[model samples]
Target: MDFENFLKKLKEKDRVTLSKVITLVDNETKEGVEFLKKFYKERKDSFRIGITGPPGVGKSTLLNKLIERFAKKYDSVSVVAVDPSSPFTGGAILGDRLRMENIYKFDNVYMRSVASRGSLGGLSSSTENILQVLEIFGTDVIFVETVGVGQSELDVMEITDLVIVTLVPESGDSIQAMKAGIMEIGDIFVINKSDREDAYRVSEYVKSILQMKYQDKELTPPVINVSAKNDTNIDELVSRIENLKEIFIQKGIIERKREIRRKKEVREILRDMFIKSIDRELKIIENKNDKDVSPYEISEKILKNIDFKSLEDIWKER
Candidate 1:
């Protein structure tokens, strides 16, 4: 369908329309880009949770568990699961939600699987756009589950009100999570697969590290052990997550973090605009026989009036 019709229907609170619009956004077409612009204009704070860890850390299972528990409390929830993108096909595999069978059918649950597109940032531009779209729809909680962890998951770290780093006892994440940067990424931590041995050890390890690191800070991250497959401690986990949400608000850091995220979003938008203008300049050069200037030539001309050699510096960096 046309963009106008899609927008009209999506704005009317129809799930089917929003689902179609989400597919469009997933494709990242020109219409999809426009839809995102309209989508973000209505954006507000949605309860965003990032569940991330290395592969096979029970992220999907934990996500499914959280969906069941959270859906009971929230009126509506949106989930964005990031999967590996095909290097050749230029699309995401979208496999992260294959295990989230039950939540997909709930009218209150909307989940979309996104391909990572090999972006080092962990989140593609479209992933960020989709999260904002969920917020626009007024979802009570928006969960973003990343396939792998590390610095890339840090992208979600900036945007979410709470970050849950999920891991099993034997995965060595107990040690990995203590890395200075990793510890800072989570507001709360989850030791999934709690039925396994050393789950409490992992929890104790996290706590000891938190005490050492935050010797002066007011709040330290909380760790919970839960078995996603067996549904053990799921309700308590949900309640703890809800509690952290208020702690974040009380500290006033969440709003500050979001302000920085907004700044980065604006910078990306401006960068995209400038890149498109350069592409347009190149196209004009390609079509014209003699007089039209290449993007480099146009850049030189634009920079000539300024004495700082801006284009020259940019070229040097490239």
Candidate 2:
């Protein structure tokens, strides 16, 4: 189908077409690029939330409960649950949907599982673009759940309005969390499996760290305890999330954050183009008798071939 018709179907909430569009964009096809260029401008509003943490932290269960709360309050909600890529197939197990099976019956709730695809920070290469596609699909709120790959989970902060870092009592000491970079990314910290013996200790440890980190700031991040299995403290979590949204708006940080993310996206695209161009140049050198030349000399040749002036112009134009 034509891009225009596909967009129309997207607005009409056709699941099949939406799935196709997501797949096309995930592959970064020409059609997908065109589709994003045409429709992304119209998507000016949507709240994005990122949920990330270590493996076996009950992130999925917590998200499912949160989605239930969000569904009732928002017009439409969608999820992008990222999974680890299989070494053999380079595809995700896509098991998050199974965890959230109960919410499948809700028409307003759209869920998709994405493979990490070797991208660091537990996100897929296409995740940023897919957010634009979801915006075009008339989703009010979107949730991005990372693959829970330790320090790599920080990338979710680039795309989300609020970042929730879920942890269990067994996740370890506060110093370890800080070292893992989870301490820096969490806008809100959730201690799941609160019934465990060490849950309070973990929460206390995090609270002390937050106090030390944000002592000079007016807004300090909150750490809450919850048991997703028992449906406990979920309402409080929902309230905290809503409150943080208001706080962000009042602080006027949301627009500034978006601007920064846009610049990062532009740089990422340029970096990709540069890498591809260099790879093509390298292939020619590899086919020739260039082994006599130093690696530095070959790199110099690649740099000389690049149109730096054109690159500057492209950067300036956009």
| TM-score of each model, paired residue for residue | 0.81, 0.92
* Cα lDDT of model 1 by residue, 27-104, tens digit: 666666777765566766888888887788888888888888778778888888877666777765577667897586
Evaluated at residue 163, the lDDT of candidate 1 is: 86
Candidate-wise lDDT, in order: 0.74, 0.83
Model 2 per-residue lDDT tens digits across residues 1-318:
488899889889898998999998898877887899788786847899999887788889998998888888888999998887876777556788767854685779998888878675468778998889999998999999985566456689988888999988887554474544778888999999999898889898888888888864647889999999999999999999999999898888888889999999989887876765566567778898867889998888778787776655544443
Model 1 misplacement above 4 A: 1-8, 38-41, 88-91, 173-178, 216-218, 278-318
| Cα-lDDT of candidate 2 | 0.83
